[model samples]
Target: MKTAKLDKLREQIAAIKAEIVSVERAQLTTPEIEARVDGFIQEMKRTVANDVLDSAGTLTYINQLGSGAGNWPVVGSWMHARPAIGFAMAVTLNPEAFRAMVLEAALKELNGGRQEHATGRVELVEQLRGKLRLLEQDEEAEVLRLEENGIDALRRADADPAVVLGLAA
Candidate 1:
C-alpha cells in the first residue's frame, strides 16, 4: 500500500514538473507583440507632443491656474478632469520619460498574469515535494516492517501464499 502511494506521489511530481515547463514556455508577450506595442507608444508620443505644441497657449493658461503647476494632486486632478490635454502636455514635456513610464506600466500589466500562474506552479511543486517526502518515509517504514517480519508476514498480509512460501525458502 505504501509502495502504491509512493508511485502515485512520484507521478504527481512528474506531472507538476511538466506543468512548470509548460507554463515557463507560455509567455505573455512575443517579440512581435513587444515591437508592436513599442511602435504604438512611440506614435502616440509623437501625436500627443504635436497636439500639445499646437495648444501651448491653452497649457500655459492651465499652468497659471492653481490646478496645473507644481502640485501633484492638483495636476492629477486636472489630468482626471481633462485626460487628453493632460496626456498631451505630459508627453510633450518629456517624451522619453513618458514613454518609459508607459512601457513600465504596460509591462507590469502584461506580466502580472504570468507571474500569478508561475507562483501557483511554484506552490504546487512545494506541496507535491512535501507529499513525496512523506510517502518516501512511509515506503521506507514499510520496507523495514517487511524485512523484520520475513515471508511469513507477507503470506499473512494477503500476498500470494505460494509466492511467499517459495520465496521463504
Candidate 2:
C-alpha cells in the first residue's frame, strides 16, 4: 500500500510538471507579440490603400492628387511601437474584453481631431470619419471594461527599454 501511494504521488507530480510546460509554451514572448502587432499594422495599411484607391477611382487619378495638406493619419503609423505592443498584449490576454477597449481608444483619437474643410485631404478625413462612425455603431457596451488591465499593460510596455527606445523588432 505504501509503495502504491508513493508511485501515484510521483505520477501526479509528473503530470503537473507537464501542465506547467504547456502553459509556458502557450504564452507569447514580447518580441513575438510585437511581431503580431506589426502584422496587424500591415493589414491596416492594405485596407487604407484599398480605401484610397476606391476614393480616387484609378491609380492615375491618385497620382495626380499629390500630397494633401491636411493632417491625415498614416495608416501604418497610427499606433506607435510601444503602445501598439501593449495594446496587442492586452487584446491577446483578454480578446473579447480588450478589443472593444482598443477600438474605443482609437475612435477617441480619430474623433478628437479638429474638423477640416476645403482641404486637399478632405476625402481621406471623411473616409476615416465614416469608418469611425461604423465602429462606434458596432460596439456593444461601454468602453474600457478592463481599464485597469489595459493601463497596467501600457505602463509595463512604456517601461520596457526596447519599447521606449523603439527597438521593438
Candidate 3:
C-alpha cells in the first residue's frame, strides 16, 4: 500500500474536521440568528401575502341558520371559513411571540442540517481511520516479510555457492 495516499487521506480528514470546527465557531447566537430569521420570514410572508391577497381579492363571510332538532335527518348549513381572521388576530395579539415561534422552528431546521453535515464528516473520518489502520497493518506485514527474506539470503551467502545455485551433489 502507498503511504503517500495514506498521508493524503489523513490530511483530508484533518481538513474536514477543521471545517466543522470553523462552522461551529462561526455560528451566531440563537437570539441573533432567530431575529434574523424572523425578519426574513416576516418580509417573505408579507410579500407573499400581498401578492395572494391582490390576486385572490377579499374573502366573503356568510352566516346561515337551519332548523333541525333531534330528528332522523339533521340539516345544517356551513358558511365560508374565517381562518384568516383567526390567523390575523393571533399574529396581531402577540407579534413577537409569533415571530419567536417561527424563529425557533427555523432554527430547528438549520440545526438539523448542521447536525446532518457533522454526522457525515464524522463517518468520513471513521472510514479514513479504518483505511489508515489497514494500510499500516499491510506495511508492517511487508516489512516483516522483507526482514525474513534478507535473513535467508544472508544464510545462503555463508554456504557453498554450488549448494546455493542448485548444483549440490
Please provide, for model 3 over 1-169, each residue's C-alpha lDDT reduced to its tens digit, 9 standing for 90 to 100. Answer: 2345434544554555555465554445566676676676566457445534443332321232223431211111111243353355456556788887887676775664433243355565566445544444443444345466562212212233443344423
Count: clashes, candidate 2 = 0
Q: Give per-model TM-scores.
A: 0.29, 0.28, 0.29
- For 15-75, candidate 2 gives per-residue lDDT tens digits of 5444434433343433444455556655555554454434444334434443543223232
lDDT-sorted candidate list, best first: 1, 3, 2
- Candidate 1 overall Cα lDDT vs. reference? 0.52
In model 3, the clashing pairs are: none
For model 1 the local lDDT of residue 15 reads 65
Given candidate 1, what's the lDDT at residue 150?
63
Number of the candidate with higher lDDT, 2 or 3: 3
Model 3, global lDDT: 0.47
Q: What lDDT score belongs to each candidate, Candidate 1 first? A: 0.52, 0.39, 0.47
Which segments of model 1 are wrong by more than 4 Å? 2-40, 46-82, 101-169
